[model samples]
Target: MILVTGGAGYIGTHVVRSLIRHGMDVVVYDRRPLPQPLLDGKPFLPVPFVVADLADRQALDETFEKYEFEAVIHLAGDIVVSESVAEPEKYYLNNVGGGMSLLAAMRRYGVMKIVFSSTAALFGLPERVPILEDDPVRPINPYGRTKWMFEQMLDDYDRAYGLKFVSLRYFNASGADSSGLIGEAHDPETHLIPLVLEVPLQKRPYVSIFGTDYDTPDGTAIRDYIHVSDLAEAHVLAVKYLRDASESRCYNLGNGRGHSVREVIATAEEVVGASIRTVETPRRPGDAERLIAGNERIINELSWKPNYNDLNVIVESAWRWHKGQN
Candidate 1:
């Protein structure tokens, strides 16, 4: 059985469904209880859920004791990059400190395999386009620093104990399930595709484009936006890789294609059949210029491939889900 911390979250929901579709037993542990609206009639409904923060040692111990977990997909962490800068203590205490609590419990219960949800922010400003897994990491924000710090802990744990891990550095996780049963639904959605979709949904006045003077063709930052389902599939493959007793590894998951902010808005406009307004703004701290992914490593190793790599297709999926929400 697999234990998914934060399994009720945006990405966590998809990952849990993927694990179920792959014929693995899953139990979710999150700081918040599972939202009933998310699973009232979904195909992968009724997954065992444990509601508690990762820092709660009692909750972790009880969960570890109850479930005979083979591996863990650790996704329960503070994710807002901008918020992390203003209140770094929250990021450290939750992302880093919470992770320590989870790791200690995993060690105690002999569940040493974990698939960590990492981010591309660790590569603050890459020296080249299509960043590689081995690229230098100099995180400029507290959130990225927290992820980097947690990854360092994984490496140290691997050396000290017999813990094996697969850290997946996702570029930009967007889109939703075609069924519209689940999708990206962050409280204050910070992702570009969803934020742009909001203009059409009448939720926001205009899409804010940060970093308009970038070196990219569109003069806006370019990011590799891999579909959410594609990212979910990688987690299943990573757990399988570790299950095979393979060595600890880290891989970058992306579409291998870069889309500028203008391209994203254009795609959303076409998908929603409505012209979305936009405003140019300064770059947010810790944002990279061009963050296309060189995902050959995961491709060759896990035989992982992205089914929805096109910008139009990616935005269309999100449009379907968001339209359903309204």
Candidate 2:
């Protein structure tokens, strides 16, 4: 059985569904309760779930004792970049410290494989567009630093203890499950697509464009957005790759295409058939002009290609899910 941490969250839930679809026995270890109305209906209700923080060593040990996890999909971590900056201690403790506890439990249980949900933030300010796995990692914020630190730990553990790992550095994970049963739902939503769609949903009056003076073609920041299901597929492939191979690997997951903020808003407008009001605001500090992923590594190595590569398709899927919620 595979253990998925943070399996109740946005990306985690999608990955859980994907794993179940692949006929894998899955168990979720998350602090949050399982979301009601499981996405694909009653089938998801039978999956085992353990509610506990990763920092709780006893909980981790008990969970390991209860389930024979062949591999772990680690996604439980502090994700808010701005919050990480404000409360570095929270990020370090839960992200880095909690990971250490998890590793310790894995060592005791003899579970040797993991699929980590890494981020492109590790690249920081990239030297060029289409970031590669070999790019110099100089994370500027606490969130990115914590992820990079865990990755370094993974490298050491792999060399010393034979703990195999696959780190999938995701770009921008957008969209919802095609089934439309579950999707991105955050308290203070920060993702671009969801925040933009909120305007049309009447949740907000207007979406704020952080900056319009960027050097991109549209004079707005550009980012690569990958559908959540595609990311889930990559995680499954990574798990299989590690099970067969001895060496650890890291790959960037994206569409290999960058879309500006203006372009995304325009696409959302087209998808929802409503003009999204926008207000230009000054660029936030450390905001990169463009951040796109170089996905050739995953494509070539794992034969994984994104099915929802189109921005309109991504926006439409997100719209459908968000509209259903309202």
Candidate 3:
């Protein structure tokens, strides 16, 4: 059976759905209570949901004791970059401290494999465009620093013990399930697509454009936004690769296609049939100028082909999800 930490959140929930679709026994451990969509009555409900925090070692030990989990996809970590900057200690506690606790639990049990959800922030201020996996790790924020620290921990664990793992450093994860059953729903969403879509839905007053004078074509930041479904599919493959006893690997999950902030807003307007009010603001601290992932490794190694590569397709999927929520 596969255990998913933080599987109740936007990305983890989709991972659970994809794992179930692939006929894998799955259980979700999330600090937050499972939303109504993942509840038993929903048609698109995935696997069993268990509300547990990885930060609590006792709870994690109990969970490991109860399930004969062969592999675990660790996604339960504090992710808000702004929040992390405000409270670096919190990120360390949750991302680093909680990660250590989970690793200890896995050691206590015989669980040998893990697929971690890492971020592109680990490669802050890329030395070159299309950042590679081996790029020097220099994170500009606490959130990215925490992820990098865990990667190092994974290496340590691998050397001392025989804990094999895969760390998928994702660029920018957007979009939602094609079926619109589950989607991004954060208390204060920071992702671009959803924030723009929310403007048309009147959920937010306007979308903020941070740094409108970058060296890009549109004078704005360029990012590689991989669809959520595609990311989930990669996780499934990562789990399978581990189950096959493959060596520990790292893959960058992205479309290899870059989209500017202006282009994203324009596409969102077209998809939602309404213009998004915009406001210019000073560049967000620690925000990179441009980030486009070098997905050749994942493409060649994992054979990951993103179906929703087009910007319009990405925006349309997210638009459907936002409208459904209304």
Give the winner by TM-score: 2
Computed on alpha carbons, the lDDT of every model, listed in order, comes to 0.90, 0.91, 0.88
Error of 2 at 147 (Å): 0.4
Instruction: Mark the 10 consecutive residues where model 3 has the least summed lDDT.
Output: 34-43
Q: Summarize candidate 1's per-residue lDDT along 1-326 as a digit string, tens digits.
A: 99999998999988987898898899999978765554445544458899999989998999999989999999998888889888999999999999999999999999999999999888988898688999899899999999999999999999999799999999899988777778888876888888999888999999888888887787998889999999999999999999876589989989888988999998888888889999888987667788988899999999998998888988999988899889
Evaluated at residue 264, the lDDT of candidate 3 is: 98
**Model 2 misplaced regions, further than 4 Å:** 38-45
Q: C-alpha displacement of 76 in model 2, angstroms?
A: 0.6
Error of 1 at 277 (Å): 1.0
User: Which of the two, 2 or 3, has more TM-score?
Assistant: 2
| TM per prediction | 0.97, 0.98, 0.97
lDDT of 1 at 307: 94
lDDT of 3: 0.88
Task: Output the better candidate (1/2) by lDDT.
Answer: 2
**Candidate 1's error at 184, in angstroms?**
0.8
Superposed by TM-score, candidate 1 places the C-alpha of residue 40 at a distance from the truth, in angstroms, of 10
